[model samples]
Structure formats: structure tokens, C-alpha cells
Target: MRIVSVRTWALAVFGIVASYASLYWVQANTVDGITPPLVGNLPSIVIQGIGVAVMVYVVAQLGLRQPIGRQWAWLTAGSASFWIGSIVWAYYEVVLEQPVPFPGLPDLFYLALYPLAAIGLFSAVSAFGKLFDTRVPLALAAAVSAVATGAVYFAVFRTIAADAQLSAIEKIISFFYPLGDIWLLLFPAAALALTAGQLRGGRLAWPWWIVVLGYLMVAAADVMFTVGTWDDTYQSGSIIDTGWWLGFSAVAVAASLMLDVQRPRDTGEVAS
Candidate 1:
């Protein structure tokens, strides 16, 4: 069990490092002095996929020995899965298809990915929500927000199909996309806060606050970029976009390390 835990941690660390390296390569090799839109996005997705795989392995290791470990393992693995889906969607939407390109078969796949990611994220929140008494409300809010966002996005899609010049769908999709992100933000923040509280109680685990902080930073950067470029082409050169991805990748690595460190000991003890 100890060996397995160590192996998982090693894999997580490797995944983090590898992801960052790939991202760095993408940034360094910008085409025509402009960061290729897809370049920035694709590496992140690949890295995240690697991170998710590592997390699943780690979770499996923990679950083998402890019952409660199974719950935490699932939560982490589930979140990773969602992250992977989001990464894939981003790759297809932002990287693969862009610049007046209508979403094709890939778009269908991309759209499907969002809901799956949403479900995985929700499941993770539910599994760990007890940490915060507000889990129920947060979960409900997230669900409602997701549905609302989806409906608005769908409406825009319909309008776009009906009349290419109609900006109503674009307007609606733009207005509510951030609202959808808000749901993503809430539950993770709640979970981190709960984990922080546990740390305060003398839990010797890797601080959940680290992951929380990283996630919040990423979310904030995303919001800023979304608003900043709302009226312009979604370019990747802005300090906010590039810097955000770099910071996000770094934080993800840190979070993976923290998870590795927090892996429960053989005594079956876990941070509450």
C-alpha cells in the first residue's frame, strides 16, 4: 500500500511537470509573433488529461486500504475527469475550431463534454460537500446556473441558425457564460474552505487551501479574460490570458503535490 501510494504521488508530480513543460513549449513557439490561439489551449488540455490519470491512480491506491479513503479518492478522481472533459472541449472549441468556423461534429462532441464535466464536477462537490454545511445550497445553485446557462446558449444557437445577422443569441450566450462559471466557482470554493477548516483543526494533511487558492486564481483570470476580450477576438497574447494559463499550470502542479502529500498514512488516518 505504501509503495502504491508513493507510486501515485510520483505519477501526479510527473504529470504536473510534464504539463507545464508542454505549455511552456507552446508559449515559446508562437507563430507569426502571435501566440497561436490553439497552441495555448491544447497543451493545457493534454496536461490536464495527464493530471487526471495520475489522480485516478493515486485515488485507487488510497481506496484499496481505507473505506473513507474511497470517498476522497472518488471525489478527486471525479474532479480530474471533469477537468479532462473541460480541457477536451476547450481544445475542440477554442483550438481546433475557430475564426468563423461553425461548430461541426467536433462541436457536438464539445457540447456534450461540457455537461459531462458539469456532472463530474457536481458529483465531486456532492461527495465532499459535507465539509461545508452549505453543500446543498451550493449544489442547487450550481445546477440551476448550469441549466440556465445551457438554455441561454441553446437559444443563441437557434437564433444564429435562423438568422446569421441576429446578435441576440450571441448577446445571450455572452451574458450568461460567466454565470455558468460562477457555479463552477462556488462548490470548489466551498470545498476548499471546508478543507481549510479541517486543517485548522490540526489535520496534518496538505492544505486544501492551496488547491482552493490556485483554482480561484484561475477562475479570476478566466473571468477577466472573458470580460476583457468580450468585444474583441479571443486572442491569447494578453498578459491576462498567457499569464493566467502559466499561473494555472503552476498551481495545478502545486495542488497535485499537495494531494500526494495528503495521501493518508497506513494507519488509515485521513484529514477530516
Candidate 2:
């Protein structure tokens, strides 16, 4: 018991350190023309990479200690894709001394995160049974996505890309942000639906809530970044970055808590 308690404490401290360190590094290294050493992109790399590692560790070491399941595997892969995108962006920002290209490797990884994460969340909810059936909840999720996406497009994207000088590629890239945000917003909605009537709740409920919050935070951070980029006012170390730090940290926390949560059913069990 003491050993487990100490290990949990260690994870908490590590998470706090990693989250704040990324924020501090971003703030310190955002100069336009001046280039820092490897430190320039180190913060982004470390934050995302550590986030991936922590999520996997939590799912593997703490999450039931059974063989790593498809749900956790998908989530881990999603984080890894984001980390890879971060590294690619860092290379573009630091080594090349240029902006990351539109529709590039970074974008590929970033885009991949959505479907993978969605699948993972879907799988997680499916474990709780018919709470998230295909008909009502999915229709509701789609309706929510449509409304939210429409509002965001009108309010944010329209204003940002209204310039005549913007090209086809630019418009596409600008659209990607909102699309991704909308897709991510589905997780929490599904999670809420899944746990709606259950009073006592499964062991997995807390972790699911944490993951849901993390996804929502990611969407919120993306929104801020989109708006900030449109206005040309987003800064590297700004408070906007906190969304990601907190979001990823929440995910890590979920992973760590997985062991204490109820074990997820196998794929076959969930499908039935």
C-alpha cells in the first residue's frame, strides 16, 4: 500500500513538473527572429511526448494490469500521433526557421488524432452497454456537432478567412481547426449519455469523466488557437497554452487511475 501511494505521488509530481515546464519553455522561447538551441522546440516535444508516455504507462501499469486493450491502445496511438506532429512542428519552427507547411506531415498526424481518439472514446462508452446506442445518442451527437460547427464557422472561420488574398489551401487549413474541434466535442457528450441514469456508476466512470474533460479542453484550446491565429495575436507561452497542458494532464491522470477503475470488457464483449 505504501509503495502504491508513493508511486502515485511520484506520477502526480512528474505530471505537474512536465505540464508547467512546457508552459515556461514556450513563454521563454517565443522571440521572432532569435533562435534558441535545441530548447526552442524542446518544450513542445517534451510536453506531448511525456503526455503520450504517461497515458500509456497509466493504461498499461495502472489500468487493470491485464493485457493492454484496444481502447487504451487507440488512445495511446492518438497521443503518439499528436506528439509526432509536435516534433515535426518543432523541426519546422526551430531547425528550418520557418512556419510549418500547410497540409504537411504535422497536419497528417494532427488529423489522425481525431478518428483515433473518437474510436477510443466510443469503445470506452460501449463498455457501459446500451447507454450509447447508435440511434438516439449518435443522432444527438451529430446534431450537436452541426450546431456547434455552424456557429464556429460563422463566428470564427468566416472572420478569419474573409480576406480576398486567402488561397484554396489556406481556406482548407483554416477549416481543419473547427472540424477537428467539432469531432472532439463528441466524446464528452457520449460519455455523459453513457452515465446518465446510473447512480452508483461503474469504476470506470471517474476516468471516463476525466478523459471527457480532457477532450473538451482540447477543443477549447483549439478554438482559442484558431481565434488567436486569425487575429495574429496568439503567443507561444500565453495562457491559451494552459488548455493543452491541463487537457493532457487530465488524460494522464485518467490513465493512472485506470488500474483503480473497473476493468474494461474485451472487444467481443463490448460488441454484444
Candidate 3:
């Protein structure tokens, strides 16, 4: 128990330090060609990788404390998928000595995260039993998803599809990135509905909200990446790269917060 706590603190500290270092590096250096310096790539990869691993560990610990069934499995799997995908991306940057390919093997793993995380969050919420009504939340999720999809189509898909430089496959894969985000946002919106304007069980919703926030950051980050790519202005180690780490850090914190969940005893036992 003490060891876990210590390790968690250490990882948290590392995340903080890496974040500052990354920002400082970006601010201190002028644009060095298109690729970021190793300083930027290494810290972002190492810190975020460790952070996500820690979050997975925390989720696993929570499962051991209570009967979470496969809820933890889905969340951890989703987190792990992204972490693995990041590693593959790093391999291209670090080991292969090449630019990371767009819509390459990494996309398979990255895209998988959307479905996996959506299921994981849904399972986590449902595991609370029927304590909270979900009708409004469900509707809200659909509405938000619709709006986001429309915005993404107009802002991202139309441009990518119309680009004369991209082949059909490239355009199709580019579209998938934002499309996946639209789907991913629904899980958190539903969670927001369950937690909004309530106090009793709303505490449980914090982790969900945190994950939602993380995904939101991710969505924003990806948008910047896409726009940069489209305009031929994307830099590998630019400030935009910080978004991925920060987002994952939020996810790590969310996973850690779940450690305190009492695991609802029964629907009636929980306060309304």
C-alpha cells in the first residue's frame, strides 16, 4: 500500500517536471526545421507513457478492492491501447529515424481506443447499477455528438476530402481521426448528465468528468495537428505536442480518483 502511494506520487512529480521541461524547450528554441528536438520527443513519450501506465495500475488496484467486473478491463485496455500506439509512433521518431507516418500501423491502435474507451466508460457507469436515471444524459450525449460531428465535418473532413495532394486512402483515414473523436465524446457527455446538478452520488462522477476532460483536450490537440498537417505547418516537437501529455495526465488522475470508489452496495443503499 505504501509502495503504491509512493510510486503514484513519484509519477505525479515526474509528470509535472516533464510538462515544464517540454514547455521550456519549446519556448526557448526557435523552429528547428520541421521535427522537434529529441528533448521534446523523449520527455513527452517517457513521461506520458509512465503516466498512463500508472493510471492503468490504479484502475487495476481498484478492481482488486471491489467487484468492478470487466469495467476496469475496458478502461485499462483503452488506456493501454493509446499508450502502445504512442510507443509505436515514438519508434518511428526514435528508432527508425523517420517521420511518423500518417494513417499507418499506429492508427489501427489509436483508432481502437475510441470504441474501447467508450465501452469502458459505459461499463463503468452501468456498474453503478440503476441508481441514477440516464434518459436526459443519453439525449444530451446525442445532441452534443451531433453538433460536434457537424463541426468536425465542416472544419476537418471537408478540407481533407477536398485536398488535391492526398490520395483517397489518405483522405479516408484522415476523416476517421475526427470521426473517432465524435464517437469518443459521447461517453463523457452521458457521464456529465449523470453527475450534473446532483450531490449524493455525483462524487463518483468526478473520474468520469476527468476522463471526459482528457478526451476533450485530446480532441482539441488532434484538431491542431490536423490543421497543421493540412497547412504544411505541423512541427513534430512543437507546443501542440504538449496537449497529448497533458491529456493523458488528466486520464491518469481520473484513474487514480477511481481508487476511492466504494463500489455501490445496492441501488437503495446509495443516497439520492
* Candidate topping TM-score: 3
| Error at 72, model 1, angstroms | 5.9
Q: TM-score of every model?
A: 0.53, 0.76, 0.81
* Every candidate's lDDT: 0.47, 0.63, 0.66
If candidate 2 were superposed on the true structure by all CA atoms, what would the RMSD be? 6.2
Overall local distance difference test of candidate 2: 0.63
Give the per-residue lDDT of model 1 (tens digit) for 1-272: 22224443454455556655665676587766567656656665565556555545545655545533454454454345445545554665575675432322322432332344345445545545556565555555557546745664574434434555536644444443344344554345444445435443533223344444444544455555444544354554344444334434433443344444565454233232
| Better-scoring candidate (lDDT), 1 or 3 | 3
Winner by lDDT? 3
For candidate 3, lDDT tens digit of each residue in 128-202? 436557666766777887898899888777877787988888777666666666676454535653644364446
lDDT of 2 by residue, 85-129 (tens): 877877777788776665577878877887787676666556644
Q: Rate residue 206 of model 1 by lDDT.
A: 34
TM-score of 3: 0.81
Q: lDDT, candidate 1, residue 38? A: 65
Ranking by lDDT: 3, 2, 1
| Candidate 3 lDDT score relative to the true structure | 0.66
